[model samples]
Target chain A: MTAVLCRHFGLHHMDIAEDIASDTFLKASEHWALNGVPDNPTAWLYTVARNKAKDYFKRTAIFETKVRNEIIPESIENEGEFDYNGRIIADSQLAMIFAVCNPANPSESQICLALQILCGFSVEEIADAFLTKIETIRKRLQRGRKNLRNNSFQITTLNETDIRSRLPIVLRTLYLLFNEGYFSKTSSKQVRIELCSEAMRLTLLLTENTLTNTPQVNALLALMCFQSSRLDARTDIRGEAILFDEQDKSRWDQSLIQRGNYYLVNATDRQEVSKYHLEAGIAYWHTAPADDSKWTHILQLYNQLIVVEYSPITALNRVFAFAKVHGKDKAIVEAEKLGLEQNSYYHALLGYLYAQTAAAKSIAHYEQAIQLTKSPTEKRTWQKEITLLRQDKR
Target chain B: MKEFALIFRLTDISDFQPSPEQMQERMNWLGSIAARNQLVDKGNTLLPVPGSAKTVKPDNVVTDGPYTEIKEFISGYIVIKAATIEEAVVIAKENPIFKIGGSIEVREVLKRD
Candidate 1:
């Protein structure tokens, strides 16, 4: 709705777009509680958003200086008409995304702006997801918004050339968005699911358009679908993180896995093997039957993934697969070389790898993991691992 | 079966913004009542906004304005048919508003028949 509203008025005030979106929710909460939810809640929200957008424009903008001033009649209320058409909203969203993914902003700002602008997440929500301070997120959003406003990014239908150049950056933002959700440290399962779904929804918007539907986009979408399939099984009844091995396979959403396979196949017809393609293949293997070959395939994908886009998380994960394929000792040798000492997952992985041969080292690593993680559930889980390892020690 | 109206009250709604999941949760609770065929009438919200009530006395004066000063106000109501007050209270107990610290008052509706 903010995107649509920005489009409605020639895209002058981005901050007003955000404020209106927030106010629309406030109105809906007040109105719906008093009047009950309307038959078409989505339509209701859109209408409220439209009104609030106009209200915000009137209240906040300096009418004499804004783009609206040129066309404004005596009563500016009816000057700009909001188009609620699905295609137009998609176009506006694309514009908003491209504006956020502007090469000038740092990669972190790009992801943060995408979360705030494209995904309709509050700054606080983005902060919660990143496990960073709200003030830091606020400043990042301010900087991103400032960059966008200074650039005067217009909300127009993207041309083919613009789509061609910007689509990769947009896809990367969504990819990181999905990963942020998939690998969240937050204990709230609902928050994780919401973030992942929002990413998928925006990516689906891209896939719906012919100009933007590229192989890498499809691959990223496929990867998200595959990971989201396991969202439910990734947590236990108590909201603690469940190890991949212990999670129930039946709980994985088969439908999402099927959708992922479809997209992955769609991705293969294209020549370029982006990191998303590799990651999608890896995620697909996770849904496959766990056998020795599965580990081998996953290990191979991780090897390619590291080469494609080497990050600490990918290296850590690659080490896990290496452990599965070769012996634990060899994997441990590789893992220790990464030197991700501050990472809880690294410590936890080390704990898992050492459990069999070196119980004392395993317990020590679990204790380190417990200390490194901020999540209470993760701390408790590592504590439990230490207890189990102690029993094995005797 | 006796008809009962469950009135929902909230302390503050000025800043209440229900997320998609919370909206879905509330809808699920409403769906459950309808599924049991106990839902009689989805009642209207008595207070349009917080403190939107108007009172008129015998004289021509009227007293009503923003209830911003008040701590609580009726948000809405829903009517359900149940065999007894206990059953009505059980239905009221299931309202999702309570999850956010709101309360529900379930009362039997009197009909002159």
Candidate 2:
């Protein structure tokens, strides 16, 4: 079913392909429920899909004015019924990925459309995944599709020459897919298994493709593998989020760590460093921790990241890394400038800084943090930090 | 590109004091979502009643009166990118305000140009 859909998508319009697929399923679903299961469900689905495709083209002759003449003859419609041996040149999913995430549209729209068309996510599901309104995701998807059509987007043929230029966007899309899987801001549940698996599948595909087998691609795959290995440990048995320091190291997959190390070496082969390279370095540091003192190198990487990204969020992250290297004083000095004191993490960081200094102002920061944070897990963590600070002073 | 104004009105503020942790959680949820989606060009949450001055004209005389209505106050809004009214409606359905109690009025934002 997947292969047939891919083939049809490449030869015909994707909108037509999608509509045909949807009609086929609607018929199959209704038919199967009444007539019991068919002997060959895949074949049945193909016949339906092909017939729907023909009907769609016939019906939409007005809007399909651009390529009205390109439709295959009625006799050829049955030819795609069972061409299992025929060459499947380009992957439809690949075309869809490039078409949706085309650089012509905004980044958010790219991600939203990719999630919807490629991953088959509903607007509500995507909204939950990114912790945004359903309207935002819907608009992004709609706009992205319109833009792609208007721009006459040409999907980058995943060949050796164009791979280097387009690889970064693909990798970023994969990263977003994985992050949505690993830590969904909207789902009350812990993780999105489907999204995670889809991301992993795409990454594996990228690694397998001769054109996309770059050191950075390998590094991204490795990072995903290593990070995913600990997904089981990220949430407690109660299904609440577990802080990184509290996670059971024994639960971390050794094989994935080894794979991560392999990619880390590959990523460093190029003298130029990207954010993924720094991220992989951080992941590696976490993997092989003799003590918390070894985090200085990781801090240096975050410093480099801030210079490149110049995000207040990145700067906030670097402050914690600084605490691991220097004392709380240096870290607090950095954190103070981030203006995150109005947020929850700021209070948690403040509480820790106060614990180190036993200063009266530290309590105020902790209180502010407690006031700002929303999650129960985060609140508890900050509360614990505040309690410890008070205990030390007493 | 078409324009749409998402008029988000905060409804039913329960006698709830969101602890700092809750505030952080909300901020993280909102900030990350906004960053990922880029839904708004710029937005600011209005204070409950940021000292308002109202002039009441009664019998050809002007008088100062605090004019407030619970149902029709504009809390906040975001101007967004949309192609059509249906698209705007689809986007509005996903708003946090529209979940259980609150509502968002999605209208085409008029362009000056």
Candidate 3:
């Protein structure tokens, strides 16, 4: 809806487009309750929205007579525009994705805007995804919109010259968006799936576009698909976090794995490899049965990923992969040097490594992990492990 | 086989905004039942998005509000063919709605031959 309205209201009126879309939904809810949903709901929504836009333009003093005549539709009925215009809407939405991921704004705000405007995510969802407060998300979004409005930002959707250059920021925003949804501890499984799906949808959009169909986009899509296939198995029936080893392999979505393979194959169309490509490679290896070969492949990918973008978490994960590739003792040496005492996962990994060697050290590490962990679900799982580990203390 | 109506009731859906994935999950749940040849009738849902629950009585009397006063509203229903109410309940137990605080009442449907 924002995309469709962007076409009529122009790029500067993106917020106005959003308001009109919301108003259209409000009108639908009220009228549909009184008169029942129409035979073709999307068609009905399109017609009503177009009519509302026409009325809005007629009443607003934003434009001169000449501009109003040019911008506003003649009549909602005369155009026979009852159905959804998918092609144009996709193009408009692709433009919005690029526009919303403005490099001028803080990366976090860009993601907040993408979630709120592009994905129809409520502030609460965004907050839950980021483990932040609702007020903080609202303020961040307000700040982003303020920057756009105060600057009279012109997105210039047609400019293909810099589209290739601007792809990184957009991809980064999408990667962050996907990670928040896929890896969030507090959000329900449904929210996780929704946000991950939204990120994948946008990435797929870029892949389908003639100009933006880069290998990087395909790699990102592949990574999302691979991760999404394991989403259901990531949590147990009680909603407790399940580590990858404990997850029921049968529960994984096979079709999605196949789809990920297809996209990964497509990503190999070019020579340049990205962080997404390496991540996707690791994720693909995870979908297969756990073996020495699988661990070796995953370790290699992690090594590449760390080199491409070195973060503390990446280093920690690479160590885990190293444990799988080499041995636990060597991996423990590498992990101890990282100095990630604040990270719960880091502690948990340390506990796992020390379990077979020094039982007391393992128990101590697990206890520390239980202390540092914020999620009650994770705390419960680790506490149970500590109880079992204590039995073998002697 | 006997028929049963599995009425889906949701608790306080005022803020429920069904995402693309949630909608697809709902469809998959229904599809699973249909695949098992248990689906008798796929009923319409009073979705929170298009929420409209009206009560009509005799003599042109009607009320335009959903049953939010009771803190629960009939979101949807589906007819399923099962040998017993217990069997019908097994099918109802599979609904994704329960993940989000919804209930399914599996009542045997009366049939006149």
Candidate 4:
């Protein structure tokens, strides 16, 4: 059923494909539990899917009459590959992805909608995944769907020309989705391993597709591979976060590192200097042979990343890389410019940098970092730094 | 072998009346729980007390039948088979039908020796 959905819908509509498949199975389970098991399971599954799609359309119509215009008629007459009834919607997943990624809607909304509709996740689950409220997710999805309808966004297959244009947004959405699943933003007990795996699977699909084999895609894939290699070491026996430097590097999946390196090399084949290229390069540099002085190489990549995507977090990372490549004076200049006390990570890094300088204010910066950080792990790490700095001052 | 009955008493507060749906949900949850533990023999809700007048020896007095200052009136309860007060108290923790500002008072039923 999932394969059929993939074949019909496309790779992007993962949420929808999973939803329909799950719904079909749930119906099957409920029916078989109540009555005896059906003789023909596949036909029964299709019937259930058809009914679900119909019900969905009816519900959509009932909720908003405006959407009635966009509703695909259930009539089997002249039904082709796009028909949801007996004709079977070929590449439906891709169609759904393109619809969600439609330029009419905001990028966040597109990603949220894809997560909700294609990925079969409830708004609450997505909300938990992103550390946002359920209401916020609902609103975003509502706005996104409305935009999709308003724009009348319908495209079957993306061309090479447009794939490059759309691929970054697609990659970013998947990357963030994987991140949320890997490290759930909420205090939920279980890590959403399925979401993370699904995101990687989708990225692999893009990588395999003829039109989408761009350098950016390769870079993103590389980044995901490198990050995924450390998934096991991210959480300890108690499921608490482990610091990056403190992680057991021996436990890191060597196979994933090799794969990441492979993609990283592929990403460099193109001339364009995308943020993914720089970010993946940085990841490769970290996971490379530790003894090699790759700091200069990494510092250059960070500089490029900063130029492309100068977000606060990126800037913070850049400062650390600069500190490694250059000396404390150059690093401190960049750190001070960021107003370290405001951002916890920035403050923590500044505290470390100041401690290295053996300055009197290092303790103050560490204290500021400890106060600013909310994460228990982060706070503990910073507090330790503060203690060391204070002892050094003595 | 010893047989003991735990008589659990409860009161319904009028201001804390739950909606019909909420009441149904609470009742369903409680019913399932009681059935699972075989604690409930019977339970019910009584309508509000009516005003009544009674003639005394010398003077006539007119007041509500309940004769209580507290808002809550004796609502309903279930009979439980328990060996001791400690056991009955443990059962009380699992009761799902406790509404706002309501309390359960459990007492040992005296068996004639």
Comparison by lDDT, 1 against 3, better one: 3
Q: How do the predictions measure up, each by TM-score?
A: 0.69, 0.65, 0.72, 0.63
Top lDDT prediction, candidate number: 3
Model 4 CAPRI quality: incorrect
A179 Cα displacement, candidate 3 (Å): 0.9
Candidate 4 lDDT, A76-164, residue by residue in tens: 22223423443234244444554567677777787688777667678888787776788999999888867765664444455666666
lDDT of candidate 2 over A216-312, digit per residue (tens):
7777777787787787777766556777888898998888788777767766766677777777777777777657556766666665555444454
Residues A154-192, model 1: lDDT tens digits: 666678898888888888888878888887888777778
Model 2: per-residue Cα lDDT at residue A304: 53
Best by DockQ: 2
| Model 4 agreement with the true structure over B1-113: per-residue lDDT tens digits | 12234333335545335676455444433432232233434444543446332223336654554425554455556565555778666656655446454567776666778
lDDT of 3 by residue, A1-394 (tens): 8766765565566777778889989999999999999998988887877777766766663464565555444432333443357776887788888878877799999999999888998889889888889999999998898886676655445578778777999999999999988877774778878889999999999998989988889999999999999999989777777888888999999999999999999999567999989999989999988665888677667655664565767777877877886699988876775667898888888988998888888888888998998888788988887887888774
> Candidate 4 — which residues are off by over 4 angstroms?
A1-23, A32-44, A51-90, A155-164, A181-184, A187-195, A339-341, A356-360, A370-377, A387-394, B1-113
**Per-prediction RMSD in angstroms?**
27.1, 19.1, 26.2, 26.3
Writing each residue's lDDT as its tens digit, candidate 1 over B11-99 gives 76652456765654454455345534466775665654536676565779676743445777777788888989998887677677877
Interface RMSD of each: 23.3, 11.3, 20.9, 28.4
TM-score of 4: 0.63
- Per-residue alpha-carbon lDDT of candidate 2 for residues B2-113, written as tens digits (9 for 90 to 100): 7777776655444123465444333332332232232445355544442443545668865432334444345666666655879667656655454436677878877788
